[model samples]
Structure formats: C-alpha cells, structure tokens
Target: MGDTFSSLLELGGPVVLILLVISIAALAVILAKVFQFASARVGRHGLVRQAVTQWRTGERNTAAQNLIKDRSLSAALVRNAMDAIQMLDQQPLSSQERDIREERLREEISARAADRLFALASWLKALDLVTQIAPLLGLFGTVLGMIDTFQTLQESGAAANPATLAGGIWVALLTTACGLAVAIPVSVAVTWFETRLEKERAALEVLLTGVFTAGSSSTVAST
Candidate 1:
C-alpha cells in the first residue's frame, strides 16, 4: 500500500500531494463532528420532550430535574428558558411588566440557541471550501502535466513516441481523478452535517416555544 501511494504521488506530483493532505484533514473534521454530534445526543430528544410535557402540566421542578443529566443543545436551551421563566414568575410584576420580561427572556434564549448551533457548526466552512476547490486543484494539476508532456513531445520532433504520449496523458489525468475522489465524499459529508444542523435548529425553536406556551397556559388556567 505504501509503495502504491508513493508511486501515485510521484506520478500526480505536488497537486496530488496537496489533495492527499486535504483528504486527511477532511476525514479528521468529519470524525470530530461525528463524535461531537453523538456526545451532544443531537437528535435524541425523547427526554427533552418528556421534560417539556412535565413543564406543561405545571410540574416545573420535575421538568427541570428530568433535564439535569441531558447534554443536548435543545436540553440546555430549554433548561435556561425554564429557569428564566421560573424566576420571572417569582417576581411581583404587573401584567405589562410580565409581558416585557417574557419577550426579553425569549430573545435571550434565542441568542443562546444561535450560539450553541454556531459552535456545533464550527470548521464546516473549511470542509465546504475543500469541496469547492478540490476538483479545480486536480484539473490544475492535470493541465500542468499536459503542458509538460507536450513540451517533451515537441522536443522529440519526428521521433515522438505514441506510447510515451499515451502514458503521459493518463498520468496527467490522475490528479483530476484524485481531486474528484477527495471532493465527492467531502461533499456528501458536508450535506449530511448541514442537514443535521438544520434539524437541531428547528428542534431548539420548537422546544423553546413549547416551554413558553406551556407556562402561559398554566398561568391562564390558574387565573
């Protein structure tokens, strides 16, 4: 395997080398993101939903306790919003003051949700750049190889060998193949990661809304 890789690098030249480095980096980023999503339990929201249901039924302390061990982004935002609302309820404020406070709390929770999502989305742009440029880089390498091949052919004049030209052409095209190899997988990974992020974002919005709405409903029923 090492011999094959070295031979490929020799044939593909600097462009192939760059692509190899990029592929390794992209793989690292993908693995890291996978671990991050798993650790945060990105899509596993059953517990969070249960907590929200508890909150809706006026079991505020139980709702908060249910989420105490949850580490998902949605759980964090829900906890914060729940704590904020609980604090707001404890105060002796007029109806107008309560409305103003609730709006401010929502904004603060939204901002926090954005920040958490942003953190999850870190290093995504570098992968995107790789997807965009890998093919072009391979093409650039192929073009350079072709130029060199033709230059050699020109120097050979009448003695230019057809077999040599054929060999040169395939070797020149190797960079382009390598580029696509790097790019296709990276593109797919980026797409998957992006889809997950969007889902998480939507989930956070819904969960927070439920918290606030549930709190309001509970208040209305009591009054």
Candidate 2:
C-alpha cells in the first residue's frame, strides 16, 4: 500500500503542487474578505447606533459627518436614513398619519441596511463559485491523465506494463481527491455563512427599529 501511494504521488506531483498553490490563493482571498467584512460591520454598526442615539436626543451637536467617518456602505445607510428623518420632520402630516409615515421611514432605513448586508453576502457567493470551479478543474486534470495513461498502454507492445497504466490512473484519481479537498471545506464555510445571514437580517431589523423610534420621538417633540 505504501509503495503504491508513493508511486502515485510521484506521478501526480506537479498537478498536486499546482492545486496546492491555487487552494492557498483562494483561501487567502476568503480570509481577507471575511476580515474586512467583520471589521467594517462591527465598526459601522457601533457608529450607526451612536448616531441614532444622538438623533433621538435632539442633539444639535451631531452632524452626519461627525457620526459616520468612513465611506462604507453602512455609513451610507445611516446618512440616508438621517436625511429621510430630516425630510419627515419638515412635513405637515397629522398625528393619525404620522404612524404610517414612521413605518415608511423605518422600511426605507431597513432597505438601506439590507443593501449593505447584501454586499457583504457577495463574498460568500464568490467562495461558493470557487467551490464549484475547483471540482471541474480536477475533472479536467483527470481526463488529461487518463488520455496519457491510455497512450502509454498502447505503446507498451505485447508486454502489459501494469505499472505505467496504474501510475496514470492514480494520477487522474489524485486530481479528483485534491479538487474535492479544496471544494468541500469552502462549500461548508459558505453554508455556515448562509445560515448566519438570517441572523444578520434580524440585527438590521433591530437597528432600523432604533432609528425609527428616534425619528418618531422627534415628530412628537415638534408636535
């Protein structure tokens, strides 16, 4: 078994190495994207909550510029919501209609939040694409290896060269294994993130609630 494995490795060494390099590259991209998403999400969510608090308190001291520092999507959402709140504040809608107006404002803010979160979800989709691509690449490599094995068999004359055919077949199978190794882990991670997406949607709903409450309080204060 050990000798068979060693011979197989020797046959597919170059393909295995190439697969390793590609897998490492894909893993690095995924890690960097995840880190960026996490950092921005945490930072921007905190800033949004702070801005909502100040807006609720009727604090004249808070500017959107002062509240949201970066050009992140989350910051854009908060800025847009604040603008909506300002516009609503200027309206002459009656108290009975105010609740409907408040619900509209909340939905608008939630939409902004969903858009930002959707951008983050794109990274997971990219990882999923990589998973799908890896297996196809492995299959291509296997097909090429099989072609080479059959050629070697035809050239062997009357003497059946078992070792040559076995080596080629092993090389082909190894590509499949290598491809699956990269694909399985990536797909699993994508699945995990997919499940977490609903949790994130809930968080955005909560944040929007806070923003709407703040907006409604402002309306009450003016009345």
Best candidate according to lDDT: 1
Q: List residue ranges in candidate 2 displaced over 4 A.
A: 1-21, 41-93, 206-223
Predicted model with the maximum TM-score: 1
* lDDT of model 2 at position 198: 64
Which ranges in model 1 have alpha carbons more than 4 Å from their true place?
216-223
- TM-score of each predicted structure versus truth: 0.95, 0.65
For 95-206, candidate 2 gives per-residue lDDT tens digits of: 7787787777677677667776776677676788879988877777788889988987888877868887886798788888888998999888788667666666765566
Report clashes for each candidate as comma-separated counts: 0, 0
lDDT (tens digit, per residue) of candidate 1 on 1-223: 9999999999999999999999999999999999998988888789999999888887888899889899887888899899889888888888899999999999988998898889889999999999999999999999999999999999999999999999999999999999999999999999999999999988888888999887554484594
Worst 10 residues of 1 by lDDT: 214-223
The RMSD of every model to the true structure, in order and in angstroms, is 1.5, 5.7
